[model samples]
Target: MVNWQFWKRRTPARILRLRPRGELSDAVRVEFPELAPDVRTYLGQAAYLQLGYFETLTRLIRATPDLAEKEALSLAAGAALRKHLALLAEIREEDADPAELMEPFREPLDAFRRATVGARPRETMLTVHITAGLLDDFYLALASGYGERGRRVARILRADNDRRQLAELLTETIRGDEEWRALLSLWARRLVGDTLLVARGALLLDGDGRGEAARAVEPVFTALMAAHARRMDALGLAS
Candidate 1:
C-alpha cells in the first residue's frame, strides 16, 4: 500500500543534512523485488525506533553529571545516530517516505519509553545494552532472508561495539554492589520481555504473504533468548 519508490528523484532534507549525497554508500543498491509491503513498513518503523532511542540517550547523557560517564554515553549515542541515519538513507532510496514510515511507530515507541524508564545511570546503561542486543538478534534473524542491500543495512545496525565499552563501565561500577546488580538484572529482564513483544509484532507484520519466511519466528526467538542469556552471563548476572 505504501509507495516503495516515492523518493526516487528527491532526497529528504533530514537525511541530506546528515551526510552528503556523494558520500552515501551504493552498497544499498540491491533490489528486493519480492519483499512484502508490510515487511518494508516494519523495517521503516525499526529505523524510527533507532532514531527515537538515540534522542532519548542524548537527553540522558546531558542529565548525567560525571564527565567520564557522560563522555561514554555521548560516544554511544553518536554512533547509534549515525547507524540509524545510514539505515534510513537505504530505506529512503527504495522510495519510502521517512516521515510517513516513522509515524506508526511514534506512539508505540513513546509508550515503550514511558513503561521502561530507568532511574539511575547504571540502570539506563544496562537497559541500552540489553535493548541493543535484542534488536541486533532480531535484525540478524530477518537479514537471513534479505537481499544484499537489506543485509548490509542489518550489518550496520548490528555493528554496535561502541556501546560495549559503556557496558563494561557499568559492569565495573556495579561490580560488588549486590543490591544494584539485582536491580539491574531485574530491569534487563523486563526490557527483554518488552522488546520481544515489539519484535513479534514486526515479524508477524512481515509474515503476511511469505509463508516460509513467517516460519522463522521460533528460531529467531530461540536465538535471541540464547544471546540474551550470554549477555546476562557476561555482566555476571544469573540467566
Candidate 2:
C-alpha cells in the first residue's frame, strides 16, 4: 500500500516560489486549501488519473485532431476515476458499480464526449469548461485509498521525454490559435498551482524526486492558466 500519509508531510519547495504577478483573488484562495488528510488521500488517486489525461492531451495536441483519440482519453480518465469511487464505496461497504459511480458527472461526460467527437474548436473549449466544473462540483466524492495504481499512471504520463514533448506541444498549441492559447493558459495555471500542494504531500511516497519533478512543472502550469484567464476576461468569456 502506498503510504500517502508519509508523502503528506513534506512542504514542497515550489509553493513559496509561486509569485503570480497579481494576487490570487479571494475566490481563488477559497479554491485552494491546505492539505488535509482527507484531501491528500483523494489526490493520491486524482493526481494519478490527471497525469494520464495530461499525457493524452499532450500527444493529441501534436497529432492531427483525432476526435476518437480525444474521446478515448476522456473515457479512460472517467473510468479510472469511477473505479476509484467504487473502491471507496466497497471499503465503506456501499455497493457501487464503477460505471454507476460516475452518474453525478453524466451531463459533463456527455459534454466531454460531444467535444471529443467532431465538435468545433470553440465547442471543445466548452467541454473543458464542463469537465473542470463537474470535477469541482463533485470533488468531495472522490476516493482516498490505495493510490499506487494511480501513481503508476502518473509515472508513465510524466516521463521525462514525454514531458519535453508535452512542453513543446503546449508551446505550439499556444501559437495555434487565440482561444486555445487562452484556455490552455488558464487551465494550466490553476492545475499547476493546485497540484503543487498535491506533490508536496506525495514527497515521501517515492522519495525519488517525484516532488522535485512536480515543483519543476509548476511554473509552466501557472503561466499558462494565467494567460488564459487574462484572455478570457478580455474576450468576455467569463461571466
Candidate 3:
C-alpha cells in the first residue's frame, strides 16, 4: 500500500504544483480529468466560499421568502462546497487508508468545522443586511478573522430590529446583472486558488505572520464582503 502519511504530506504539494497561474478549472481538468466535471461544479460553489461570491450567494438566498426555496439554495450551495472538501480528503487519502491520518488533526479540524456549521443559514441574514444598506462594523469584525468566528459574531449582532430589516430587504426589489456575476466569478476563482494553496501547503496557516490560517483568510472574506456591498450599492439595491 502507498504510504498514506506520505500521500497526506504530498497532497498539498501536488495540488499546489498543478497550478502556478491561469484558470483553475483548466488546471483541475488537466490534473484530474475524471474529476473535471465535479471540480467545475465544486469551484462554482467554492467561489461562494470565495470573497464576493459567498456574500452574493448569501444575498440572493436571503432575498427569497419561501422557506423551501431558501433551504434548497443552502443545500445546493453548501452541498457543493462540502463535496469539494470531501474530494480534498479523498486526494489526501489516495495512497493509503485515510483512517490512519484522521487521528492527528481530526480534533482541531472538527472543532473548526462545527464552528462554521451555521454559515449557510447565518449567511442569509448577513447578506440580507448588506442588501438593506446597513453596514455593521461589528458584523465585519466577526467575519473578518476566521469566518466561523465571524458567523458567531454576526449571530450576536442580529437583534430583533436587524432581523426585521433583513426581512424587508428580502421582500424588496432585485435586479440581476451580468457584470456583477462576472466579477464575482473571477473573485471566486482566485479565492479557491488561495484556499487550495493553504490546504495543500503552498502556505502554512500558522507560520510567521500567519497566526492562524483562518485569520489569514479573514481579509479575503472581508474584501469579498466589501465587493458584494459595492455591487449592491452600484445596482441600487442598497441606498
lDDT of each: 0.63, 0.37, 0.33
The lDDT, on a scale of 0 to 1, for candidate 2 is: 0.37
Tell me, by lDDT, which candidate is best.
1
- Cand. 3 Cα-lDDT: 0.33
Distance (Å) between predicted and true CA of 106, model 3?
A: 3.3
Estimate, for each residue in 31-147, the C-alpha lDDT of model 2 and write its tens digit: 122222333333434433343334334444445376644454445445434544434444233233434433433443333333343234333333333233223222321111224
TM-score of each: 0.77, 0.29, 0.29
- Show where candidate 2 strays beyond 4 Å: 1-95, 112-167, 176-239
Question: Which segments of model 3 are wrong by more than 4 Å?
Answer: 1-66, 81-93, 99-105, 114-120, 123-202, 205-207, 210-239
lDDT by residue (92-135, candidate 3, tens digit) is 43453334434443443333223322244433343323322222
For residue 209, model 2's alpha carbon misses the true position, in angstroms, by 44
